[model samples]
Target: MTRLVVIGNGMVGARFVEDVLSADTAGRYDVTVIGSEGCEPYNRVLLSEVVAGKHDFSALTLPTPDSPRLTVLRGTHAVRLDREDRHVETADAARVRYDRLVLATGSDARVPGLTGLRNREGLTSGVHALRTIDDAREIVAATLNARRAVVLGAGVLGMEAACGLARRGVAVTVVHPAAALMERQLDEDASRVVESAMTGLGIDQRVGRGAVEALVAHGRLTGLLLDDGEVVPAELLVLATGTVPSTALAADAGLAVDRGVVVGDDLSSPTDHRVAALGDCAQPPEGGSGLVAQGWEQSRRLAARLCSPALSATFASGSAKAVPDRDPTSNVSDVVRLKAHGLDVVTMGVCGSQRTDDPAQRTLHLSDPDLGRHVEVVVSGGLLVGATCVGAGPVAAELVTTYTRRTPVPSDPAHLLISALTPQPRGATGSVADLPDDATVCRCNGVSKAAIVSCVHDGAATVDQVAAGTRATTGCGGCVDDVCALLAAVSTPAPGEPTDSPTTSRPREDDVTKGKHMIHSAETAGS
Candidate 1:
């Protein structure tokens, strides 16, 4: 049997193993996964929820069910790769042989260029980075004694850490170099709404400035010295600056390394056909968004390629094959959503301030600072190309679905938001039933309405069962309502069924289905 050795047991690596095992059920390959973390793969996306006291460590861990064909080596770090011998040297001095190697090495949190970050030993006290589950736990423990805490960076991780700490009654302040929060994703208008909403949540924000130094006095962190000569008092500092792709192993092995490990259209290393890369560590020739959904797509596609009969024959013949363009997840939604309570933010596609010269481009902006609501839309060719929604309530989900499905908009785009806040008029342009089956319901997993319907037909009668079977509403949990809507639309209830249960009957405006319950389940699934 061909041996497949996978480095890094992150979400991407674990998922690739799952896809491989599911496809190669005949046990054609002996698979071994080398994980740096000691525990089973857990969802890193929900790490903020863990710090918020919403989920325990074990709750976030993914399943690694026993299989005769698979072996998982937890807490094993690959230190060196010998491509000639097709073996990897682990930190523990053990060597793992492989016919094929997959580098899903993921990424590492980037710490700011600050002084006194460490002594002879690594990572001084009162300083932490929220990258791993262990890091979240450390931050959570620090919050217990931290009356005042400062999170450096106004990006997603920083905002998430700030919100999580504030939720636990810790006085939190976020310092970012960018003028607006999540500036890369949200426009200035949407950022202002989110900033105001977060301020009300007991989190202070300082923008357009960054920390100059991590101040350490007598073996303990006092606070951070800002670039503007202002010192922020804090007992704890959580650095959510950003992450850099972990590409050392690939680079050392003589593989092409750019911003990340360079891979072809097939997710295989350009210099080595026996090797492949995925997740944050990989930069595919067609490009990548560094999103989990994209990583999942790479994992799934790579698995299919490795298990294909053509691949087996080509491998035996030592023949070269052209990398076909079969990546479907690339078209997945670029929506950046926050799952925090009382903060509903979704930023997708282009929300930039600069107006495009293209006549086909249409931009709409709405901002109500008092109500803390912001909405921006960029339409090209009569379809939404970009959108940002802040505190738009359930209308945010509706807008996302409309955008994802490429449904025709009303003559007035503002009507989209209006219909969401209040009851729709007698005649509305779009409804859930009108959505195409091919339209992606779960953007993170690339799950379409037809897939959910097929799952329902395959004994996935309930929402949770559908999630388990098809991975709908799994990532980001933003599409839970969509999944529920599709479930109610497709599922047929038994005779004398309650109105609350799944039914073939179309969803009425007044009928309260199991949508909220399913959404809650989806939101808290990995929590």
Candidate 2:
């Protein structure tokens, strides 16, 4: 059996291992995984939910793969890569040999270098960064007594964290260096609506401000001193500045490293064909979106290539064939949605802020600051190329679907923004059951309605079972309601039959329609 070693057992890394095990039915490889966290892999994307008291720590646990040929080294840190020896050295002086190596060393939460941020003990009390499960736990625990909190960033993660803390009845203030929140995804107009919505949720914002120092009192955080010489009083501080890709291991091994480990579309390092990298630690030609869905796609593609018979034959001869380059445009819809309660913000492709003056690009904008709603769509080549929607759930949902599916835009792009408000035909409710078999229900995993129904037919009755079988509702968790709706439609018994199954009871049509509205409007929009 070929030896395979994978580093960084995070969400993407773990999914890659699962994909390999699923495809390698011949038992052709012995897989070993290294995780620095000491615990089983969990969904790091939902850490904000944990902070909101929406789920317990145990709820974040991910399913572990059980196989005799697989070995997992939890709490172990890989210290060195011996390229010449074809092995990895751990911090505990252990070495693991491998014929193939995968680096999924994701990323680290970047903590800004502000005065009084750190002391002799490192990161004075009450200052925390939300990256790991442990960090979420610490933040949640602190929220019990934290009446006032300050979040130092206005990116997706920062806004989510701020809203989460506010949900816990904490007065949260978000300080951002950027003039607008989520500037990468939202333009100034859409951001204004989002800011208004967040304000309605009782979260304060200070845009275009920088944190000059963290004020500590008696070894604990008391407030943040801004560059404007203003001190915002707070008992706790959460840093959501950004993330720095963990490429030290790859760089130290003499592999190419830019912002991340440089790899080709095939995800193979130029210097070493035997070594591969994916997830946040690797920079591919198409660039990294820093989204878990993108990493999951990379993992799926790499695993497919590695398990191909052609590659297997080449590996046996101590040589490997290059995997065909993936189409750059395939799955290029980088949808970013803020998964915070009471916030409906979603953006995709080229955002409103990034729209250019090209004559061929058709752009439409609608803003209602008083109503806290903004919608913008950019059309090019008769296809929806970019969109930004804030404080408008149904509109956001429709735009996301159009953008991801590359649906042709109406001659007048205004219809794209107002179509959600237009009435549907009689008995033509928006239902998952009405969707075609090929309709994508889970954009994160690309699971189709047919795939989900197949799982239902295979005796997967609950949402969790369907997720385990089809990998739906596992990314961004935006499709759980849709999956549940489908499950009901698939499992409901015919009119005269006895309802014995737990899911045999059918949901009321009105309830289903209401659910559709809530899901499309509130549940991360699409992804």
Candidate 3:
């Protein structure tokens, strides 16, 4: 059997291992997974939720089954990589040989070098970075007696962390350099709605300012000193600035490294075909978003290439003459949903307002500051190109579904912001039942309406069962509501309750290969 060695056993790495093993059912390869963390691979995206008491630490770990032929090494760090010998040396003084190698090293939370934030003993108490389970635990510990907390960076992580702290009755203030929260995902109007929502959540915000120093008193964090000479008193300071791809091991191994480990459309090293890189650690030629969905798609594509030679050949043949060579899976829509509770925000495709004179690339917007709701839609070539919905209730989910499925917008742009609770006028596009079977329900897992229906037909009734069977809503948890709605529609009703049939029974081609990719393409609008 061929020996396959995978390093950095995070979520993407673990998923790739499962996909390869499932495809190679004949035991064609002996797989080994090496994880840097001491325990099994866990979901890093839900760390904020864990800190907020929504889930325990144990809930973050993926419940993967054990394979007799597969070997998993926890707390083992790969120290050296000898490409010529095709082996890796771990810190535990073991040399592991491999016929193929996959790197899922992932990325690290970008921490700035602020004075008083660090000492000879490392980060001082009350100062933390929320990136891992350990980081979440430490923050929780510090919040035990913490009353006032200041979070630096108003990005997704910072805002989420701030909200989590606020939920715990900790007075939280977010300091960011951006004029608006989630500047990359939301436009000005959408951000305003988010700001209002934050206000309702009892969270304070400081925009256009950055924390220059971690204020310390006798080696304990007392507050943060901003660039504008403003001192925000706090017992805790959490830094959620951003992230940088972890490429040290790849670079030390003499592999090509730029913003990340340089790889092709197939996620293979340009110089070494035997080695592959995926997740946040890889920088594809066409570039990549630092989103978990992109990494999940790459994992699926790479798994197909490794488990079946015929599939790889087909992909190679199609891309042989393509300009600016890219992965076929890379051209899917990427939807990002903020996981903060009570914050209804979903942003997909090209967001922000369009400026071009072309009548086709028109942008429709609705901003209700009083209602704390904002919705923006950009249309190009008469199709929905991009959308952003903030504090818009159920309409956010509808907009996400429409954007992901590439569905047509109503002739009236005003209908885009209409509440889902509001009755749809006659001649409307109908409901979720109207969605095509091929319409992706779970973009993170690529589970379509047809796939979910098939699972329902096979005795998988609950959303949890469908998730276990098809792995939908497992990635970002953004599509759980849609999955539940579909389950109710397809499952047999109790007794004489009527079952609503699908509005459209048309069967479009199901590209099950690109699950998350099927939902989100990497195209951002007004970039």
Candidate 4:
């Protein structure tokens, strides 16, 4: 059996192991996973929810595969990579051998070089960054006594952190260098709407200025000094500045490293085919979006390639055969939705002010700052190429469906914005029952409506059962409502029928296969 060693037991790393075990049913490989965290692999995407007290640590845990040939080392750090010797050296001076290696080291929070930010030990007391469960725990504990808090940075994570602190009954102030929040995803108009919505939640914003220094006294954070020499009083400080890809291991091994570990579409290192990288740690040709869905997609494709029959034969015979090529069209999803409470913001494709000037694209927008609603769409070739919606959940949902499915829009383009006000037609966005069989309900896993229906036919009565069957509602937890709705719709029997009756009709094999293929194609079209 081939020995497979994977570094970094993050969400993507653990997912790759699960996919490999599911496909390699014949026990063709002995797998070992190295994780720096002491706990099981958990969903990092929902960390903001954890800060808001919406879920406990257990809820963030991911499922692990049961296999006799698998070994996991928790709280272990990989110190060195010996590409020539085909082994990895852990911090304890132990060596783990491998025939193939996958690097999922993920990323580290980037703390700027502000004065008084760090002490002799590390970050000064009461200053924390929300990148791990420990960080969230610290932030939560601090919130219990913190009367005021300041968040540095106005990106998605920053905004989420601010809202979470406010929800805990703490006065929150956000300081960002950019003039508008989420400038990369939203234009000025949409930003104003989002700002207004946030203000309604009692959160204060100081945009176009950055935090210059940390005001610490007695080894505890007291406030943040802005660039304009203004101090925002606070007892706790949360830094959501950004993240840097954890590429030191790859770079130390003398591999090609750019902004991240440079890899091809296959996610294999150019210098060493035996080594591969994915998640936030690797930079592919299409670039990394720092989204969990993109990492999950990469994990899926890499797992497929490593478990293919062709590669297994090559490994057995010691031949130089190249791995089979993947479908070139498979692209990662670019959808960005904020997971904060009382905030409805979603953006996808080409957005912001820069793209509106494209002569080839048709743009339409409706702004209502008084009501805190803004909707914008960029259409080209009769397709929804870009969209930005704030404070409008229903319209945002419809636009997301259209954008992801590449569904043709009405000729006028105004209908895309106006249709949400009227009753939606059949197979439209309002009701789960009206969605077409092929419409995707879970964007994170790319699971379609028909797939959920098929799972119901196979006796999946609950959301957990359906998740176990189709892997829906597992990522981001944004699709739980849709999955529950579909389950209720399919599990409900005809009038006067028994309540516990099983679904009588099952989807045809051909139909299921075709639906899967179509979903795959839609996912990979713009790669």
Q: How high is the CA lDDT of each candidate model?
A: 0.76, 0.81, 0.74, 0.81
lDDT tens string, model 1, 1-527? 99999999998899889888987866799999999999989888878878877667875777675789898999879999999999999999999999999999999999766896776677778999999999998998888888999999877667777888888999988998887888877766677788899889988888888788888889888888888999898889988888999999999999999999999877888899999999899998767676787788777677767777666454334332311222132245366776665577776677644345677777777789899988877787767778778877566667666676567887777676667668666776444445666666666677666777778666565656777887765566556666666666566465777645533444443322544532232121111
TM-score of each: 0.87, 0.91, 0.87, 0.90
Single out the weakest 10-residue window by summed lDDT for candidate 1.
Answer: 518-527
Deviation from native of the Cα of residue 494 in model 1, angstroms: 5.9
Q: Which candidate leads the pack in TM-score?
A: 2
Candidate 2 lDDT (Cα, whole model)? 0.81
Q: Write the per-residue lDDT of candidate 4 for residues 1-527, one digit (tens) a residue.
A: 99999999988899889878877867788999999998999978778878977767787898888889889999989999999999999988889999999999999999999998999999999899999999999999999999999999888888888988998999999999887898878877788888889899999989888888999999999999998999999999999999999999999999899989999877899999999998899998889878777787777677767777665454344332221222122123667777676788888888874465778899889999998889999999999999898888888878877887788999999999999646667765467778878667777777778888888989876666788888776777677767766766776677887765667433344533332222111111111
By TM-score, how accurate is candidate 2?
Answer: 0.91
Clashes of each: 0, 0, 8, 3
Give each prediction's root-mean-square deviation over alpha carbons: 5.2, 4.3, 6.4, 6.3
Better by lDDT, candidate 4 or 1: 4
Model 1 TM-score, 2 decimals: 0.87
Point out where model 4 deviates above 4 Å: 309-332, 353-356, 423-429, 503-527
Candidate 1 Cα misplacement greater than 4 A, ranges: 309-330, 353-359, 410-422, 425-437, 453-458, 461-464, 481-527
User: Can you list the residue pairs that collide in candidate 1?
Assistant: none
